[model samples]
Each structure stands twice: as structure tokens, then as C-alpha cells.
Target: MAWTEAKLIAEAILEGFERHFRLFRETTAGAQARFEQADWPAVQVAARERIDFYDTRVGETVALLRREFHLRDPSDTLWRRVKVEYMRLLPQINQPELAETFYNSVFCRLFDRHYYNNSYIFVWPLISTEHLEAEVPIFRPYYPARDGFARVIARILRDAGFERRFRDMRRDIRCLLLAIRSRFPANRAIQQNFQIAVLCAPFFRNKGAYIIGKAINGADQIPFVVPILNDPEQGLYVDTLLTGVEDISNVFSFSRAYFMVDTEAPAAVVDFLRPLMPRKGKAELYTAIGFQKFGKAEFYRDFIKHLRYSSDEFMIAPGIRGMVMCVFTLPSFPYVFKIIKDRFPPPKEMTREQVKEKYQLVKMHDRVGRMADSWEYSHVAFPLDRFSPALLELLDAECAGSLERVGDQLIIKHLYIERRLSPLNLYLHSADDDDIRHAIGEYGDAIKQLAAANIFPGDFLFKNFGVTRHGRVVFYDYDELCYLTECNFRDIPEAPYPEMELSEETWYTAGPNDVFPEEFATFLLTDPRIRKVFRARHRELLDPDWWRARQASIRAGHLEDVFPYPVERRFRKDREEFPRRYPHLADG
Candidate 1:
């Protein structure tokens, strides 16, 4: 057959698959009824047999395509056709009565979505290569063909309301992939956008169906975004438009300000500005209504109290240069910063917080756009207020590259700072839902965005970030943030990567046990909160056997902390007890 004729045949097969899937979806209700009445023994036998048949059929199809096209690379032109056919086979193979019962009872439901929504590009190797030739073997020793079937079955099970059934499936799947992924050379395929969508897909597919419904109805609009300039030399003015709120009154009660002291400014600049303090950011106009005062030294003392561990050295005078500080400590961290007001000698006793509370906090009624909930919800306040002239000068210098002021707001290009965080910082987890979602989303988007932008996060961890009031999560420490395409994403084993994944003697790529902290089990076991969140999100984190095995590894020295903090800073220091006091700095 000629190439054109072959191509025509492929297109016809692809269309057949698409039409078949559509019809299956349309008749799922009826098909489900017939499925339930099928004989149990016969169904199992048929499913097992079908698994073998499909493997042979699809695997052979993949092999033949490769040979016919003389394709040598991973993303050979031949893949486009192979993918279409494989996707077409999914509904037929997975929706069959026997397969449905087994498939819909697992956590691979997200994979089902991937198959349906056409994001199965990440797992294309499983369906495309017949030989499984790579750095890691694709087939399992104990269950060669069973591994692929299980993945398919798991996806079905996940779809059929059996997400909880495969709570530990992530670990197993990771192990299965580890046994296979590295068998090939460095992945010359596409960057993985797998997790980002998976993390948020469930919410959209199930509970948050409103967003989906609105989208389907063409009622939803594209999110509005304003570019945040990174250059301060542009101008000293920026007009940030705030929207996406029904009422701003609930949030505007707090003051806000951006302290822009020069890196070359006088050291006493902090003390000089101490008296004029609490100016609120325009974003927090509705919540501006707060006053407090503290001596510069006292402010640092109280700020230090919030450190869970002592080694967080960024806030210290050393890391903080020329007093251009952007401070917004969480409510749980304690109130240490003070605001001051302006006047002759700042009225002697006037503190920054007091001044901020007096004239900064503004009352507002409404807000409008895709404003992040956390951004609009947090009370905004800036710590120093006295030295407006010096502060303004510093702002001017930083903004020499790019700065602007629209109305009363100062818009300056602030540099994103990062740190080489201790690995211990990597293990700590937060219970905040918004934090979790944002972190996971960023991580997901990074694979694609970073690849395209030529940037990459050298170290990806849960604790490396915290949530802002507006629910935006930013990386504060830069130690591990680096250029994309700089790190290995393809050859690395998938998560839950283990050491001895396939068999005792069979070496593997990335497995669940690989690089996993042995103490992770103990940490989860000791902390009920960690257990709860892990169970709530990724249940595989809660398995005792897995934990025990990990613990054993820790004992055996198979696992060690990669980013350990300094020893002296490992333990919290004892603090002298003082009487429970409110904002005492307000008086004197």
C-alpha cells in the first residue's frame, strides 16, 4: 500500500474509534445495566482474556508502526496516528462490563480523565513502544502484561467511584514505572503536565462542577491579568487594578505600605522611619484600621519569635539590606511590627503602627475581576512609617530601573529572592487548603512553563512555600530555583520512587522508595495532623506497612535527609516566660 493510502486508513480507524467512544458514552446508562447482570465467573474470564488480546493487538500495532515508518526517535511522526488509535481503544477495552467493575474501583480515575481529555501524552510510552526498549524496563517481572492491564483497570476503577480502593496505588504505580522508565535513554519526549491537571481535575469534574458548567455554557470569561514588572527603573508609578470581590469592607480594615529603604541607605533608616509607620497598600484599603507601636529593637525581637526554627536567617539585619523590607507576618506568627505617624519630631512618642492605624486604613465598598480570594481577604499593614522622605528616596532608587506610582500607591519592581533551604524545610507540610492547591498547581504548571521559559525549580518541595493573604503562593527562598531544561525530568523515576522496585536483583529507575525519607513514616505517625492531610489528599501516605518499610530503611541507613539544617538550629531555644500581654508597645 502507498503512504497516502496507509494514512487514509489510519484516519478512518481514528474516526471509528472516536465515534465508538461517543456512542459508548451516550449509552453508558444502558450498558451499565447489562454489565451488572453479567455472570461473575464468565466476566472475569472474559476480562482476563481481553487483557491479553488488547495487549497483543495494541502492542503489535505500535511495533508495526515503528518499523513501517523507520522512526528512531521518541516523538516520531508515526506517534500521532498510534496515539489516536490507542485512545480509541480505551473506551471499548475499559468500558466493557468486566473491565468497568474492576477499573472504576481505583484511584486512577484521573488517568481516565487524561485518556478522555487527551492528556495521556505523559504515559504514551506504555501504549506506543512494543519492545519497551529504554533505560528502565517497561514490563514487570512478576506480572509482565498485568502491569499495563492494571494501569488501565485502575483508571476505570477510579472512574467507577472506587478512588479510595487504590489509596496506595500511587506507590505501586510509581514502583511499576520505576521498573520501566529508565530502561530508555533520557526522555526525548515532552515535558510532563501530568500532576497539575490531576490535582485540580477532580474538583472540577465532581464538586466544583459549577465552574465547568459555566464554562460549558459560555458564561465564563477569560481571567484578566496585569503584568507585574520586574524592572524598577521604568518609573516610580504603577496602577494595579483590583477586582473580583463582592464587598471590600470585610478586608479593608487594615493598613498597608511598601518600605523602600536604599541598600546603601543609613543603617538608622529603620529607626528614623519607625515613627511614621502604618501606611496601608491600596489593595487593602477596605481593611485599613489598625495601630500599634514598637521600638525598632523590640520589633526585631518579636519578629524573631515567629521562627519555628532559629536558622531562618533572612529576616536578620545581615540578610535584610538597607531596610527595604516587605513585611506581612501571618496572624498566627504574632504582631511585632509597629507603625508611626508624621508630625514635628513625630510627636516624640508616635509609633509607626499608630500612625498607620490613624491615617492609612481606608474604608471601601466593593471590588471587581479574577482577584485571588486570599489577596482580597487579608488585612494589609506596613511596619515602618516615620521616615517618608528617606523611604521615598529608597523607593526611587530601587525603582530607578522600573517604578511607578498611580495615585497614592507606589509600584516598584521587587526582586524575587530565593534561598538554598535545608532539606528539613522540604519535609514540613502545611494543612492550608489554599496553600496546597496553589503549590500543586504551580508545580504542575512549572513542568510546561519552565520548559518553555527555560527555567526549572532545582528543588521542588511542599514546605518551600507559604500562602499570601490573597492566596497567592510565592517561593521566598531561592537556593534551589534555577533555569529550566537544566535539571533532568525525563530520566528520573516517577514519585514514590523506590529502591528495589521490580525485584531483589533487578535494578530500576525511580521508585517510591528512592530518595524518600525513611523518617517520613515516623513523622506522619507522630503527627496526627500530617496523617489527616496525607490521608485526605494522597492516602498512600498513610499506609503503616509502607511507613514501616520506610522506617526500616532509615534504620538501615538507606535513606538520609538531603537538605539537613544546621545542627545548632535544629532545636528550639528556651525563652523566658513573661506575663501574657496585649500590644503593650502601644502605650510607651
Candidate 2:
């Protein structure tokens, strides 16, 4: 039977949809079974395999449509018809949810849109590390033969009215490449198969800047650049000709742009490019930046220079645990810097390696910096030649004396510095009743904001938080920070006997991720007054149901709006309402 072109295309799309759904169902079921069995490693492997299968299947589906139906153009009428047909057929599918997802996935590719619109653009230089050895080197532009993907991307940008800008920026990028090559030459063959891609992203303009360098490979393929709206403010700082790749590249308006190098990049390369990155130390003196390290020289020159202290006068804070980094105050600076100890004293029944691993994980969390409104971070280095004789002598007397020295340089590991609170602790040592009430309220608000941002402060202890000068509570400790979604929110399993409830261990088999939000009341609200206040104001936080609802909302892609500023700055009223309130404004 001869079928019309439209009918043939619709039938092909449906077949592709079914193929995708079948594969998805099989993979999901297998992965789910592994997850239920608590075989996380197997689950991870399955998840990766599923993604690979999906990509291959989608590519095939796209190829089939292009080859057989000749439906190449995204803006083609046939694409629209296919979408309409999929919607009509969705209800008839045995697995409607999977069908809907399949439709969205194909539709997004056909329509030239991303499934998830990421805020950052990752730019990787394809140059070999060995070739980077030239005193001045120029990198050749190498576009891989990838099924006209580049041409398609160019066409999309052209249709968006950004072709000219993209071309201009590409030319500038070539110039930057030439500059980098000439400045740093390598002696060895530049044969590193994968090089670090420079991460360029826009962040809040007013917030502090942070950068981290680490080598990562063998994960996922890099993403293509997408067009963004132009922000006038961003253009002033970033050389559009140098960094801009059309509208998709214009990101500075929403936040400052950051240029980060990969750890594999030579120190010389990083040093040369340092000036091009955003300036560090922009936050207030009281603001703390987590997960920072500085060379011995840099620690003294850049950080210690700003701090005024005689070597003899440096006093470490009391009650320092192996897990808790040593904190010291500076007369010149309002904030105190925390230096992680080389080895943490192991807790009972735990090996030294385990304690070290736990500490390392905490440091890793600090580096990720996901907690909203948390402390800022920066990497710094000081020169040994610049240190004064008095400073050198002081370093000899204090804990700095035992620091690991490399040649003439001392490595300051993961320094977290924040504003020194008056009481030095958020848990009120001798605050009035009203102050305690205010502190608890602020703490509740902090928890809500963290939850909204998908962060769960693993340890909900009051000592883990600090009160800022403005009386706002901020979480400072990150040893136990984990994603709220990662936790299995559950009600405590009931015990067969009443006496069993008093036992230290649980009767039911609890997984590593299981969390009982209800227990927070007993753990955090030890004080009677604080408990009463928390129960009256933020009682919902103690309910596991609330957490589960939030997790579901997040899974369904509901993002709670979290603002950095105060409520008054939000301008909650409608623009039309403003005109009604002031008729004179309308006349103007």
C-alpha cells in the first residue's frame, strides 16, 4: 500500500517513539532492581549504560527520519505535524509517561532546544599539552568531523541573529589562542588525549568569586556552546572580541564571569592567565571563603599582609578537635582563618584512614560550594621573600611551624576564614531570652533556604552555624553537607516492645541515606525555651511529610525561588499597583 509522505513520517516517528520507550522501560527496571538491593555501584553502571543506549537510539531515530522521510529542517511543517501526532497518540500508549518523555526528547532536538538550559558555558581548548611548550605558541582550530553538527549549530545561531557576533568572537578566540601558545612553550609531545576545558559561568555580581583547578576526564562528552542574551555590564569587563562567541557568550550581566583552569595546566600557564580572571577578596572582611589553599609565601604576602599580628601573640582558639580545624584570630582582620590539621585523631572504633577520608569529604563539600548564601572562597599564594622578619619568627612559634614545607614554600591546606562573632558561637552561651528566640528564628530561616536550594546540612547542631554581624545565621560547617534528595526521608520504624524504643540501635534495617526529620526536634532543641519557640514557629520542619513533599516537588522540576537579598529589596508589589498608589507617577 502506498502511503502519503505525511502519513509515512508520522508512522516512522511513532515507531521510533516505541523503540525508545521499550529500551527505557527495560533499562529503568533493571536499574530500579539494583537500587532496591542497595547495590549502588551496580546502579551507577546501569545508569551510565542507560544514558549510552538512549543517546545511540536517539541518534538512530534522528537518522532514520532524515534518511527515509527527508525531514531535516527543524522548522519544517512535517516536524510540527509529527509533534501534533505524538500528542494525539500519547494517551493510547501503554506507558504514557515514557511516551511523553520520548516525545519531549525528540521534540527538543528537532526544535533546536536543550532539555536542560545550563547557565554556564564550558570552553575546552583542544590543544595537546606537549604542543603548549612553545615560548609563544598558537593553537590550530581543529573541528572534528561530527555529522555536520557544527554547521547545524552555526545555522541555529544565524537564525537567532548572532552569526556575525559569533564570527567576531571566534576570531578573537584565535588571537587569545595565539597569545597563550607564544607565552608558554612545551618541550614534550603535546599528546594528552583530553585537556581541561576552561569553565566560564556567570555568577551573582555582588557575591565573592572562587576558582578551583582539578583534572577530570573519562566522564561525559563536552557540550556545545549555546547563545545567551547580551548584558551591557558584562561586556564592560569581558573582552567581547576575546571571550564572546555571540549572544550565547554574553553572560556577565547576571553575574561576574569566572575563568578557571584545569589542574593539568602548568603553573606558569595559570600564573600568566591569573590577571585575566576576576579579582579575588571582593567580599567583606567578615565574610568567609571555604576550601582555599595558599603557598607559604602567598599565605604570608597576600593574606598575612592584610593581617597584623606579632608571632608571639598568635593564640589558637580553645577546644580544638582533630576533625575541627585550628582557628586563630588576627587583630587587623575581623575574621579568623581555619587551617585543617594534617591528620585527624580517629574516633573510637574508626580507623585513622576512615577519619582522614571523612575530613577529605568535608573539604570536598567546601569546594563544591552549593549551599546558598554560604561563605565565599578564593585561592591565594604569598612569596617567601616578602615575609617580614617578625612574621617569620611568629610562624616558627605557632602551629604554622609544623606545616608541611615544600622547598621554600609552605602549603596552607583548605583555609576557611569567617567573621568573628561576638559570642564566637551561634548556640547562645549567655544570651537573653529575646536573643535566643531571634537566633532560633534565623536558624529556621537558614534551614528553609538551604532546603529550597536542595542542600541538607547533615549536622543540624547549633555550633555548626554562626551569627553574622547583622544577626543573620549562616551555616559554616560543611563536614556533613549532603543533598536533601540523596537522603531517604522516613518516619522512625516502630518497635515491637516499648523498651526497644530506648535502645541505641534501631530494630529495622536502616540504609545509609535514611533520615528521620522528626528526630531533629530532640537533637537540636535540647533547651526547653528553644524547643518551645521552634515548635511554635517552625514545627513543620520536624515533619518527614514536609521533606518528602519538597523532594517530590523538586523531582517534578519545581524550583523554589531563593533570593540573596532581603525581602524589602524584592519589590513584591506589581508595577500596576505602584501607579495606582501614586497617580502622580502615571501623570509623569
Candidate 3:
């Protein structure tokens, strides 16, 4: 029988759905049997099997469509039909929770194609607390997915020509006076008009329902609500508008709940709520307020004394640039804080260009603040003023050579507060034989994930990476971070003569940014025992070919999965093998 293009697409989608249903049935049956026997480990193993099965099939389906139909866009009707077919199978699944997981995985894959390719927009709707409770029955909100959803909505609105309409209406001659008074109560009028325009727009209102349904059903997740305002009247007004939408009210009613802003701005409806946003320096604000309002006077006095006079107050480690940012642990605080000064105290003999480079390196830390957070990197940074008088005094004294005294607030370069982990480096100088083996294995895995993320720790010093509380190695130093793709990975050229090989300097001229991955092991693994272990386990990292291949895959847009949790939390096929292999670290 001859098939039209649309008919062929429909048949393909149905075929994919039938395959999904069969796999779902098989996996769930196995899982349910395990569940009945109270075998949680077996149940998890089954769940992983289901997920992997679905993942492989879905990938195959996508590839088949691409090859046969030349399908490229995720927003194509083919996905819509697939989603419809999947929904029909949802109620048929034996377990409701497992069905939800299957739906999330499929939807995530579909949405990710458009999202990563910059073809879709997601808008986040701010719901009232009451509506949030009603919409989200299960309370498992994934922040990253929710954020991505909002971004997609925002993109949709901009693409649908709603942005121009909203802008024109806001700037209309009729609303000119109100627009001028927008700084005051008249701001409410402008905001209301914009909301009304959005509600009346066929594209937005129609798409709004689909967006809300996807957020509600695709994952057991909900968008984070804006902070409730201090003023009761204003708060109630915003809350009403959020849930006032007849189409999206149900999804939100069941549940209770920067820098990239240029690329992913929120939809105009949500944009109106920007005035109520809290200041970005929330950590600093809360810390300052807590010390001022709740701190004891005597405790502050004693803390100040310790900061000024304690013999233990010394630089934790020497900085590469001679800039005075050092880690210090106080009895009052459980974590270690790195206090950086405003400027590097220039060396007396340093050239102007050298001083500029040092300053730029210091500024690079701030730039890295916006990069993706990984277990390998520091997560947060706050101002020095957030600390109490005692902490500030200690910081002032400890960072004396690096510190620049400013009027009440001492100007600092960048203050980084990080969790204090084990003092021993991955080199395992002080660790036992068993720990040395474990550290080497853990470090190898950690570096692979970091490289996959496109981050290269420019400096590979053992001191820069420390073993965490769980024996995982994490790179804390941000000063030498460079994109993995930015580096040129190549083998060292041969030395012309034996005398040249013995020279301290390189025979070939090297650019400032040029890095040879081949030299990493020699430069980092100085200890004989550590070198032996690393060579045995992670010899691939020392080869330029390996680095080049990984970089090429990344450049081709292949993203490897990197989980935040430990291996035990991961649903691996060989769940029983992990405990036996790393018995001491397996539990964590």
C-alpha cells in the first residue's frame, strides 16, 4: 500500500509507541514482582533496566526518523503524536509512579532536542501558594528542568510576535501618562494591561494550557514561585493574577510550591513580577542582618581579639600569583573561608604587563562564578561584609599584604567560602595503602566528568585538588580554569640534541594558552607511589590522543551523562558489584 508523507509519519510514531509499550510492560512486570517480594535492590535494578531500554529505543526511533524522513526539528508533529500515544499508555501501566518516570524521561528527551538547539521557548507561570498545592500532587520539583521550562516559554513568546505587541502596547500614546507614572502605583496599571494583552492573545493563551499541562504531567515538578511580598495588599493582587488564568489554574492548584538572562528572558507576563524580586546578594544580606540582630556582643568582641592576635592565623597555602587570598577556619564557623584582597600588592620589580596579567587572573575568578556548578568546583561566593566584626578583623589581619582598606567595608578581591574537606591531597602522602588505591580510582572518574563538562583545570597540582569527605577528589582552585576545547592538545616536538633535552626551558616556543596533555602526569604526579597508581589506573589522561578525541566528541555536541549523586544512588546494571569493589566508600 502506497503511503503519503503524513501517513508514513503517523505509522512510524505508532510503531515507536508499540515498541515502547512492550518494553514498558516487560520492565514493569519484573519490577512489580520484585516490589511484591520487598526486594528494593531488585526493584531499583529493574527500574534502571526499564530506563535504559526506553532510552535506547527512543534514541533508535529518533535516528530512524532522521534517516528515513529527514526529520530534524523536535517541534515537528511527529513528537506531538508520539506524546499523545504515550499518554494513552500511561494509565495502562501497572505502577503509576513508574509511568510518571517513563513519561519524564521521554518528555525530557523530546524537549531537550529543541531546547539545546535554541528552537523552543518556555515560560514560567508564578502561581499562588494555594494553587501550587492543588496543581502539584507530588512534591518533587527539579529546579534545572523548571528553569529550562521557563526559558522555553520565554522563547516561544518572543518567537510568536507577542513581544512586539507587548512593547508597543506598553509604550502606546494612550498609556503614555500611565507609563511615565509606572514608577509609582501607575506601575500596576501598566502591568495589568500587559497581562490582559497576554490573556487575550490567542497564541499565548492557547499555548499556555499546553505548557502548563506539560509541566504538570511531564515530570513531578513545579515552577518555583516568586517570594511573597511584604505588603499584604500587593501580595494578594500578584497572587490572584498568577492563578487567575482559567486554563493553567488546575496544574498549579494541585501542588504547593542571571547572567544567562540575555539568552533566556522570562515571558512578559512573568516579567511584570520583576519589581518584587529580592536583591541578588541574599547571602550577604542575611548574614549581615543575623550578626547585627542576633549575635552576642561578647562573642563578637572575643572573635575580634582572636582574629587580631591568634598565632594560628596564618596563610593556609602560598598563592601562585603572590596575591593574598588564603583559607582560614574559625571555631565559630564549621567551613573554611578564603579571603581575597581588592588588589595584588605588586612586586617591587614586576613589569606593568605582568601586573596586568595578575589582575586579570584575579578577575577571572569572578567570571567563573557564572559557569555551571559541578562537584569539582566551588558553588557560592559572598562579600566580606557578610561576616561579623571578628571575622572581618581576622580577614584584615590575615590578608594584610593582600588587603586594601576601604571605608567601613574593606575592599577585597573576591571572598570564597567553601566546605572544608580532608586536608590530604590526592597524592595520598598521609593516607593508608587502601585509601591510596581508592583515591586514585576516584580521581580518575572525577577528571573524566570535569573534562566532559568542557572545563580544564589549567593547573594540575596535587595541592589544587583535595580528597573530599567521601574520598572524592575535587578541584577547588579556579585561577587556572580554561575551557577544554580552547586548549591545543598535541605531542611535544622531538628535541634536536641530547643537550637540548636536558635544558630547563622548552626547546620549542610555547604560546601562553598552549597545553600539552601528554605532560600532565609528569607535572602533577611527582610522588613515585602516586605516579605508579595513576599510571596503572588513569594512563589515558596522560595521552594527547585521548584528550583530542574527547574534545572532538564534545565539539560534535555529544554530552555524556554526569550524575551528582554517588554510584549507589545511580541505577547501574551491576548494583551488587559496587559494594564489593569499594566496601568502605560504597555506603556514602
Candidates in descending lDDT order: 2, 3, 1
RMSD of each: 30.2, 23.1, 25.9
Q: What is the per-residue lDDT of model 3 for residues 199-278, given as tens digits with 9 covering 90 to 100?
A: 11111100011111112323222222211111212210011112222223221210100010110111222222212222
The stretch of ten residues in a row with the least summed lDDT in candidate 2 is: 118-127
Off by over 4 Å in 3: 1-324, 342-414, 423-427, 565-588
- Clash counts for all predictions: 100, 22, 27
How much lDDT does each candidate structure score? 0.27, 0.44, 0.41
lDDT of 2: 0.44
The parts of candidate 1 lying over 4 Å away from their true place are 1-439, 446-451, 492-499, 502-588
The TM-score of candidate 3 is: 0.40
TM-scores of all candidate predictions against the true structure: 0.20, 0.44, 0.40
Full candidate order by TM-score, most accurate first = 2, 3, 1
